[model samples]
Target: MSRHFYSCPLRWSDMDAFGHVNNAVFISYLEEARIDFMFRLAPGDGSPSFSGGSVVARHEIDYKRPLVHRHEPVTIESWVTKINAASLTIAYEIKDEGQVYVRASTVVVPYDLAAGRPRRITEEERMYLLKYLDDDATGTNKSAEDAEDKDALAA
Candidate 1:
């Protein structure tokens, strides 16, 4: 599995009074990288690919260093850590230059747009996502099967 890296510019408004990028801005960068990765794997109709509305279940961020206002370009890299029928976890490492400045993980759960519930991910999507999954990730595809099986049993 290989990670997808996206290059995004640090907006002028992204800075704060401290002369560094705001904390919330980092999540925005993560969102952009995640969206870019998903678009690469699955091109949708200009909406999120996850079935159910793809709500964020968890977000954890660790800032190793601060990004100043003068950085040239920032690179945000993301890859699947685990994929499940109802939820998917993507890990991100955001950097400027060759040094890592932030490490984060987001757990996004699938939601049924029509049924208004968590939905099981399709096998095609699961397969498409595997190409972008992290090599160090353990049991990425296998976790998805359990959610799928549970959904099957429920139905």
Candidate 2:
């Protein structure tokens, strides 16, 4: 499966008084990357756009380390972790060459803006997401080698 990479620029204002990015600001960064992935890159061939409306049902974040403000941008690697009939989960990692600063996931539900309620994922949306679906069967989020080793042990 392929991953979507978004290079998010760090702003001086994004840092808190502690010289590290504010925890809350990380949410905004995730939103920016999600927008880029779902709207900017989502198919425009008459498919319903997420720009119409979508809500964050949940967010799970693990801050691995502090990220200080820098001139260079940090890359956020994103991929679809789970997709249900009415919602989908997008996973991410905010990282540089050396280490990851954050690992997170957001569960998003499509909304019918005019109807004012959540809607089921359309066939088009499902098909589009399938392209980026993870190949891992266990869904354990482990490295490929680790997963394989586990499978061998289980067998």
| Candidate 2 structure quality by residue, lDDT tens digits, 100-142 | 7788888999999999999998887888777777777232366
The parts of candidate 1 lying over 4 Å away from their true place are 44-52, 138-155
Residue 98 of model 2 has an lDDT of 56
TM-score of each: 0.79, 0.86
Q: What TM-score quantifies how close candidate 2 is to the native fold?
A: 0.86
| Model 2 spans with C-alpha error above 4 angstroms | 41-46, 137-140, 143-155
Question: Which residue window of length 10 is worst by lDDT in model 2?
Answer: 137-146
Quote the positional error of residue 53 for candidate 1 in Å: 3.2
Each model's lDDT comes to 0.76, 0.84
lDDT of 1: 0.76
Report the lDDT tens digits of candidate 1 across residue range 31-88.
Answer: 8888777666444564345533567889999776778776477888888889876678
| lDDT of model 2 at position 104 | 87
Model 1: how far is 16 from its true place, Å?
1.0
